[model samples]
Target: MSQYSILAAAVEHRLLEKNSEFITFLQPVSDREQALHWLQHYREHYKDAAHVCWAYIIGNTRQPQTQAFSDDGEPSGTAGKPMLHVLTERELGNCLAVVVRYFGGIKLGAGGLVRAYSAAVSQAAQQARLTLVSPQSLLRIAADFALEARIRQLLAQFDATLLDVQYQQGVALSVSLAAADLASFKLQLQELCAGAVSLTEPTA
Candidate 1:
């Protein structure tokens, strides 16, 4: 299975009629306070707009889930539901979407409201790129002076994420490798250490 990181907070544009506004969404937020914080900030920035309805999905596969929607005073089922629909369709987790509606002075009834809100979020999502994230095994290695160079050279060949390094009586290196590539990593490490290096998995 694969995991994906949420997009960074950024702006993307969507226009309808003579009115145009930007919608922004970002994530990893899993609590009501964080969602409200973003909502409050969004409302402040887009205060001139006619509406600022939003929806959010919180929690992941192993935790308590929460979903919320608000119409910001628009007719019931018009604004917030569509925003929620877009988030669900994308299978997004722990994310929020805010639609800054600039009323074109045109009353878009229920159908139009839904379409506009959905389209705004869709446009923003297209602009905010997502990256693949996966579980990796973190290894902690403590070695004496003689083992440093050989270990560094071996690790250089793979895309190792250096999580941390500490120096004490000896040097301790903390690195992470993709779980799928762990066996190869172990093989290379052992060859470099000549079976002397101690490798241990860190807590997730």
Candidate 2:
């Protein structure tokens, strides 16, 4: 997909079930490291809490590059799995959700725990704002100086951003555009330049 939904910013929601307090935090996380950093922060801040569980989905939530969840001593599939399901169902990517649960001298069975955790995250997600994320691709092009204006004009046609331009070697341009437009951009560039232009991608 060219674009997807992601968290606009960090958000927190509080839930109460049978005297138990569930503080849910939903935050934008770009990678596993950021997710872990946020999780650790919660763990330290809520050191007195009974359980601190978390789930994170990196990249596209549908086909995430990386994802993981933790029960944090809760029964298997009760806390973490359901929490993750909420994020996936909401189609949110590059996000982390942490629920800090404070026991209230009441024991919730597996079903109750699952419902509480899922609901906690669901409530936060529903209340949180979401922003669109468009995947971008970087490109480098080499063309004659005569095609400078044409190349620059083509960029706007494709909604491309010009990153850099080198005068040497007959105008080398560094540009970025939506990943979905890469193929069409290349084709149109070659056609417009009569196949005299060369394109290359930077090594990631």
Candidate 3:
């Protein structure tokens, strides 16, 4: 996957339009199933809500693999669409957004509902941390035990994550790092391990 932003944690924002209360929540999700799971949670939690509107974007936000939204019972195009607009405008993906409406008596006409829902999500996103997710490639390396420390240092410098390690005549390590960093990382590893290390992708 290409680099993109995702909510680092769940965020809640509140907005009042006329007498309606829009409680919006944004969460990071891996796929459609996870997004639906969270939508169901909010729906169950707010059984009395007038509407449980939701939207989600599953892959690269710019060129999404999947995207959907629902206005629930609100006026067509009033709630869910605007909420989704905010998310896409911000270039966020792998995230779910749910807006629970608590009717406050007065009805917010179509335009009003759109503005209210959009602002709710936009504000919540402002308050929440957005984390950039970079695509990672897995690599396995075998090196002498004596060179372990230097190898680890190189991995750290390249923002590589050590996933596993096995010890035999030497040490075999599984690591993951941003695909963009692979070339530079391999060069640096070559310099550090000289002719003593072997790096290869794990066999499927």
C-alpha TM-score for every candidate: 0.66, 0.95, 0.78
- In model 3, pairs of residues that clash are 19-104
lDDT of each: 0.73, 0.94, 0.88
Residue 16 displacement (Å), model 2: 0.4
Who wins the lDDT comparison? Answer: 2
For residues 70-99, what per-residue lDDT tens digits would candidate 3 score against the true structure?
999889998889888888988777889999
lDDT of 2 by residue, 73-152 (tens): 99999999999999999987989999999998899999999999999999999988888878889999999999999999
Q: Name the better of 1 and 2 by TM-score.
A: 2
Per-residue accuracy of model 1 over 131-180 as CA lDDT, tens digit each: 45555788988787689887777677778787887888887889987777
Question: 107 in model 2: Cα distance from truth in Å?
Answer: 0.9
Off by over 4 Å in 3: 1-3, 58-60, 63-66, 104-107, 143-150, 168-170, 191-197, 202-204
- Residue 166 alpha-carbon offset, candidate 2, angstroms: 2.6
Residue 181, candidate 3: how far off, in angstroms? 1.4
